[model samples]
Target: MSALTGKVVALTGGVGGAKLARGLIECLAPDQLLIVANTGDDFNHLGLSISPDLDSVMYALADLNDPQRGWGLAGESWQAMDALQQLGGADWFKLGDRDIATHLQRSVRLREGASLSQVTRELCAALGIQHRLVPMTNDRVSTMITTEQGELAFQEYFVREQCAPAVSAFRFDGIELAQPLPELMDWLAAPDLEAIIVCPSNPFVSVDPILQLRGVRAAIQAATAPVVAVSPIVGGLAVKGPAAKMMKELNMPATATAVAQWYGELLDGLMIDVVDRELVDTIETKTRVLPTLMSDLESKVDLAQAAIDFARQLD
Candidate 1:
């Protein structure tokens, strides 16, 4: 195979997205790739600044993530959380000892006037991560899940309630006031920018917060580069998280076709697992069939490589 060319931007959130992101990191040079992680899941818990999605990608890229749990550091000890629970502290959101250090430092840095991006850069450097990883924005825009029980923050719905409530709608609180870092805006308009890959993350919470920002969708629509997305839905279920459940609750099909339709005409191509290949003809946009389940490092790399090739073909 020939060497890959041009810069690529990947929008990612959660474990599945981070797995593919690690694959892209292996395939592309640090300078050629930029990873934009969703920060909508960020929240203040026990007075610590917690960025769940960003930490997921960061920990995965740094080789510190717990693969089995799909979040937090590997072999993480939870004495802190255990003690907190004993003391009647807020333990709904479990915080491992090492993971708490990360939040502690991040909170201190943010209070010291470093932007979230700057703090993230410092953390990445300490962890020896090279590829560019940035929060969707430094500004606070939170993902609010509206459930049958009423409104709840993302962590509350996901962790506390264990995603038991049926989702009725989602809102990005403070999104109207949020703005992308100037450089990201430039990337959207950069003439030489090659392709944009929307990683296989939850459409409602993970992906929407980034795209719902003012002018982001418009920028994507106006960009010349081909926009491609790897479908989070496979067969009639989500590979991870509540993407499929939310789809059903929102009166949409829990299939790759529905995923493709959700992205609509914005995508130049949509990548689906081979299990859903039979549904390709039902999709409107250009489509590719490949195994998307990242069971291991090699499979993740393969899917990342295929997505890039698909983008190059569309280009």
Candidate 2:
């Protein structure tokens, strides 16, 4: 395939989405790509602002991510978490020594009147990441997972509770009041914009929170760019995280078709794994069958290229 031209914006969540973001970064120049990360998972942990998805994307782009654990810095040490446990502090969420430094720096900057987007840009630069990375919104928006036990904060349900609760629904606490980042809005309005690639992120919590932000969905709908989504589910199961489990609990089928349906009319095309090729006939939008698993760099770049090529074809 020829070189991908024009600016492309990728909407991503934590690990799964970050993998694709890294692929896109490799496929395009720093100026040609922009990553909008989910900040719904952001919370104040141990009195420090923690943006899990942002950190994950940054780590991935900088080649500092721990592939084995699927999160945090590679060669990470857990001296802090170990000490916290010995001091009888909450140790459910493991924060490694290097990881804590990120949080501490971000927390300080945020308290110093820096916007989340500004802080993220600075952090990305510090990590030597060239491609632009922005949070979905600078405004505070928390994802609340409503489950059998009750409504719980995102991290409380995802990490502390280990995603054990059966989720019935989800809500973005401050989404109604949140505004899309100015840079993202400008990109959506740019005449030369090419495509919007929705990374294979959790539809309910990861991608939904960004969509629920005021005017974000409408902007994408109105943009001239064709929106394409990569399925997070492969062969009826989520590659990582609790997406599949959440889907089943919400009475939706744990299938690629269901994932497409959840995104609805916003999608111009949907990319499904080869294992889910059977779902093509049932999927409502235009479909592209490829191996969506990102077990390594090659697969991730190939899938990223496929998704972009499919979107270009739609044009």
Candidate 3:
């Protein structure tokens, strides 16, 4: 066993998740990490399969991430989106030129009969990212939110609608039929698996979708490794996205304590920001107060180190 080496982790969600994931990749050996990105936001746009979460994770790992925007490729140009706008197309989804290359390649591969996993692996290899990155499933499952405006796809509710719709409920369409990616299952079942870090992502839309997969929750609960979650909520606010608002709409407090409660008994430890240290004792799960915000590379690495240390101590 690789001692400090044999660790395996599975993460879901998008940019925020990717930030911590990049940090973890720096801390752990590449083979020791496995990121399971959320596909809930995935949808067909202009008859093309667009997977925002997966691409974000992949780009972040590949070191091609746009830090300023926090979501697409660095130094990107929006030619595709510009062209679509000129054609008077629905340009709600902005696909930059560099990012569009990734989408086009992925679309073409899928069209040629490649599974999402296979394409992801190929992309990872090409990008020189050594760690394993897998999608939640092989089947088409989308998170549809029932909001005041009506049922909106995750991206439509998030990106296009700017999350303006008051979410009444959410359903993962086709989740019942979605099969866990075999490679992910194999990694989860690995004997040396040491920890799972649920990244500081929007729990409702990001992590929840992955957990909703038929066997994923059960597998996580049954894993010999300890499961730790970093709270996206800090000081009654979300650092990146709409988690806080969504939580409030769901009648839950926008706090780390509430985030831990949402996870229920699934978590062995909850990583909260030092800003919310006072709420540590109030959390349902055991807590570790750290600087959870990944404002820069150092902060991200520090949080990742803290999480890995906590998990190792637990083991």
Candidate 4:
């Protein structure tokens, strides 16, 4: 895949999505790529605002995320968490000493009236990241999971409970009040826009929240750019996270083709791993068979480039 001619936009969440975003940053110039991060995982914890997916992408792009853990900062110490634990304070969510600084800055800036987009811009600059990063919306939107155990906040179900409870469905609390970021609307309307890539992220909790934002889906439908998605489900399992489990629990097959169906008409192209190539014939959307598991920088870059090529073919 050669260099793409115009601006590219990616809708992303945590971990897997962040890895692909890092790869895209390597391929596109600073002015050419825009990343819209999911804030549905945002929550208030221990008196600080925590935007998990935002920070995940931030850390991943900045080359600071812990490689072993796949979340939080590298070379981190947990003195703050240890102290908080000794004090018997709420510490189910481990906040690293270094990682706490990010939350502290974001929380204070937000409380002082800076929008999340503004704060994210500042944070990205501090880390020397040149690419543009935007939150899905500035207004409040929480991903609430309705489960066999009743309703729970996104982070509660994801982190605290370790996704133990079987999910029934998802509701984006405050979605009606949430508006799409103005830049997003403009990007969708931009005739020169090249592609809109949905990163290999959890569809239920990550990608869905961004799509469900007021008029985002309708705008994407109306956009001239091709919409491409890299299936998070490779084979019958998720590369990361509990997407596969959630799919089966929701009565959908946990396969790449099934993921294509989940996105349906929104996707002009679906990239599934070569392992699932046999199922390509079953999918209605134009599909690309490639190595979609991005374990390191090389593979991540390869997958990102493949996604770009697929998008171009769609056009």
TM-score of each: 0.98, 0.98, 0.97, 0.98
Across residues 262-290, which tens digit of lDDT does each residue of candidate 2 receive? 99999999999999998899999999998
lDDT of 4 at 149: 97
Q: Residue 62, candidate 2: how far off, in angstroms?
A: 0.6
Give the total clashing residue pairs for model 2: 0
Please give the TM-score that candidate 3 achieves against the real structure: 0.97
The candidate scoring highest on lDDT is 2
Candidate 4 lDDT trough over 10 residues, lowest sum: 1-10
lDDT of 4 by residue, 1-315 (tens): 247878889999999999999999988888888999999999999989999999999999999998789899999999999999999999889999999999999999999999999999999999999999899999999999999999999989998999999999999999999998999888888888889999999998999999999899999999989999999998899888999999999999899888888998999998889999999999889988988888899998888888887888889
lDDT of 2: 0.93
Task: Give candidate 1's total backbone clashes.
Answer: 0
Clashing pairs in 1: none
Residue 110 alpha-carbon offset, candidate 2, angstroms:
0.8
Better model by TM-score: candidate 3 vs candidate 4: 4
Q: Which 10-residue window of candidate 3 scores lowest in summed lDDT?
A: 1-10
Clashing pairs in 3: none
Go through the candidates in order and give the C-alpha RMSD of each one to the true structure.
1.1, 1.0, 1.5, 1.0
lDDT of 1 by residue, 218-306 (tens): 89889878999999999888888999999999999899898888889889999999999899999999999989999888998899888
Candidate 4 global Cα RMSD: 1.0
For model 3, residues 193-306, the per-residue Cα lDDT tens digits are 889899998898899988888888888888898998899998999988889999988999999999999999999999998899899679878888878889788888888888
